[model samples]
Target chain A: MQVTLMQGILIGIFAIIAGIDFWWEGFYIFRPMIVCTITGLILGNLTLGIVAAGLTELAFAGLTPVGGTQPPNPIMAGIMTVVLAYTTGKSPATAIGLALPFSILMQYIILFYYSAFSVLTKKLDTYAAKGETKKFTQLALLPTWIVGLSYGIIAFLCVYGAQAPMKDLVNSMPVWLSHGFEIAGSILPAVGFGLLLKSMLKAKYVPYLLIGFTAACFIKFGNLMPVAIIGVALALIEYNRSKKDVENEKKMKAVMENVNNDGDDEDGI
Target chain B: MESKNTETTPKRGKLTKHDVKMLGVRSLFNQSAMNYERMQADGWTLAMMPALKKIYKNDEKGLADSLKANLQFINTNNYTAPLLMGLEASLEENGEKRSTIDGLRIALFGPLAGIGDAITWFTILPIVAGITASFAKQGSVLGPLIFFLVYVAMFFARIPIAQLGYTTGTKAISKIRENSAIVSHAASVLGCTVIGGLIATYVQITVKTKIPVSAGHTIALQTQFFDRIFPNILPLGYTFLLYWLLKKKNVSPVILILATFIFAILFSWLGVL
Candidate 1:
């Protein structure tokens, strides 16, 4: 479970890429699930990495950056969980308890990154005023490099330097607490689904949701791909039906307009 | 909104197809330098730099002024920002009035974000992430692989939307406005369905408690009732309760997370679940 020198460097590189990708394109590679998988792959335990990531991902899934507020940083949580899980040889769910503190710490680090970098905006303003487009562009991209490097450094330190402390933290947890975490780990995804449903649930689309839940609960699809295919098929049917309904309404309006125009012409005659 | 002359052909401007294509690529950085005060203003201005330079090649004052205008507290959803930037660039290229371009930019931000966030953040990401997460949980590599591939595809999809915004100008905006409802509806249906399935698949809440019916024959609520009658009812019910707390009661998600932790501990300790 020990991270090799090469593994630590590779993890650092991945962390750097995740940091830049977080803001640039937002492909969500920075998410705990994805990052942890990459870390696990480097550490030669892909299954452990994926399981650790899956647990942490659900915890953070409910925590999207809505408006100005920041979510608990999943990147740190995910990476640290994998590191702890590997070091201690504990269940991935137990690592969730150990990783919670780091997630909170990372949230503050992100706040610091934003507040500290806000000062650079003034310099950008000057460049804009001076019509220095090249400098303006370079300065604009500065935050990405800065954040990426910081993340890289943080990953290296965590995997290479803080291994003993993290291992101690993971090994010292009481049985009841670990059981609680296992329970929490299983149920936390509900919050994410709830948050998603909060935003997406329309009265008309409720039926489609029922269909999906029913299909999954009753049928043994084995994998998510088939359920997704079914969902897509249902969506296409719903979409085409709505499209046709709208078209019908439009036709009815046109016919009504024609009748009204004829009545006007008859009055003129 | 006075309609500007559509006769200003894109070919007359200095922006080549390659430059426009590059602008689309640069649009990926729309929030890289984001801050609270100006939000994405820096990124927006940066993304449009190549196009703005060509449009005001002779007028240094024009370039400075355009840059300043763009850096004025412009925040919008990242997915839709590129289209706005492309449209703004095209307007500047066609000699559109400053007030008109600025007004349009300001006006479009709220609506575009409202629609864009709803689709991209609320619906699409959750559905995709939920599906991928389930696969990942099963120790399948396809989960991360599919997520990475689909994400790249959607990320590149913005490039074409930006290109469309630039080439067609205001017409593209109107078209998007008109068709957005259908597009949003279709996506929402798909999103909702996947999320529903995800609730059944991922949100695990199993009761292990059993009631004493007779000596040496205790009836387990999980196996005898919940499992046989309604397998995912507890998970579905729990999901709905949280959804209510979030949507109706406006509970802070952090509080909800804390509640989840406490509930899990208390319930497991009490042998309820």
Candidate 2:
């Protein structure tokens, strides 16, 4: 069954709520797994939602935002992919298609929140001036819960309601066009892979990657054997070859021993 | 109970460019730990301390200064919400309504958390982890060994960023801007690879068939295809094609999805996934 647009909106709402509820933990709360799980519950296929969530999770498992650099939105992708997959039978890749825009929209929301929070500091400052230390902490708690709860509920409803209508709409489309959606699904995951590969393929390490892949493909060995054996052998060889100042160490040791004997001889005489 | 030293010692002697570079990592790490929103309200105040010393040293402001920033190099704070909450609660205690502050914060937290998590844990870690882990997962008993090597490199690499964040935040933006471009490019390269790897790992498919030999026996896929060349390379190729089209063509993922469904239907009708 295709998801009715109303259901699509519901799933979105559900995602928003669960997404920001981690206020105590602050803005680090929005995770793909959280949104995906909510999506699963909304779509009434908790298991598939989990699987989708896990795949998305592992795919972006190493996201590390350093400073202000941008990172691709995994939670948005996770939610949409689940919605699409459960409602339309598209694979994980197809679901990723709908998630990107939501992720982008969420980004600006963060910018606003970050800047707006500064005002709270001013209020706290005012309290601090009045010699009311306890009041400063109190002023901070209200905003945290309000925002956290709002995001949680909004996501819950958006995802929950969107589930049915989106499925219906997608399914009701011409059968041929439906086929087209499936085709799109197959090709989309590659984008995720490509994004990953752009970092993996470095100029120096290309040989290691190729060799590892080749050994996996060719060698009739047990799991994880060929690569490990070769890697260890190469590492040992490199360590041995890179031994620095070997001759200098020997000369330094000889000089130290000579000095000790000379000192003893002088003392005895 | 013991105030052995009234002031902390600063590093003596002229600092080199190398030292400056290393501080960025340290500064970043410290910035990452800037939770407790009220404390973090200065927005990189911890970083600007060296410069802050010049401005506020021995000033009449009686607040003691002890600051550290930590987020493991993904420089976003988790304390802001609580910080706001604390501030609001304090105001409430003083007999003022906090509804407006609540609305303002409600509107703020969701979007920031969404992007922050995505960038920190999603893009940077995976790309770095995937490549770093790939070395080990491919290694067997030595795999764990390889993982440690990568981990050490990443761990040590972060120290300077943390320090730099603290030092740079203290002064002007001139020094920070100079290095941002190179760092961004490096980050992008890493991020791009993750984009690729995430796709590669997404959809897993298996095709099974048995071929009969002359002696009245069938061969396993392992025995038959294992002897052939580039056995799983086809999947890699497929991912590349998808990535290129998406990036170059600007085609919507939805359209591509429709195409995939069509393809799957045709393949299924012809019996292929």
Give the number of the best model, judged by TM-score.
1
> Which candidate should be chosen as best, given lDDT against the real structure?
1
| Model 1 interface DockQ | 0.61
- Tell me, per candidate, how large a share of the native contacts it keeps: 0.65, 0.13
Instruction: Write model 1 residue lDDT over B216-268, tens digit each, in one string.
Output: 88999998998887889988898889999999999977678679889988887
When summed lDDT is taken over every stretch of 10 residues in candidate 2 chain B, the lowest stretch is B64-73
Model 2 TM-score (B-chain only): 0.37
**Model 2, residue B244: what's the lDDT?**
66
Per-residue lDDT of candidate 1, residues A179-205 (tens digit): 777777778778877877777797988
- What are the models' TM-scores? 0.90, 0.47
- The CA lDDT at A205 in model 1 is 81
Locate the minimum summed-lDDT window of 10 residues in model 1 chain A.
A60-69
On a 0 to 100 scale, what is the lDDT of residue B219 in model 1? 91
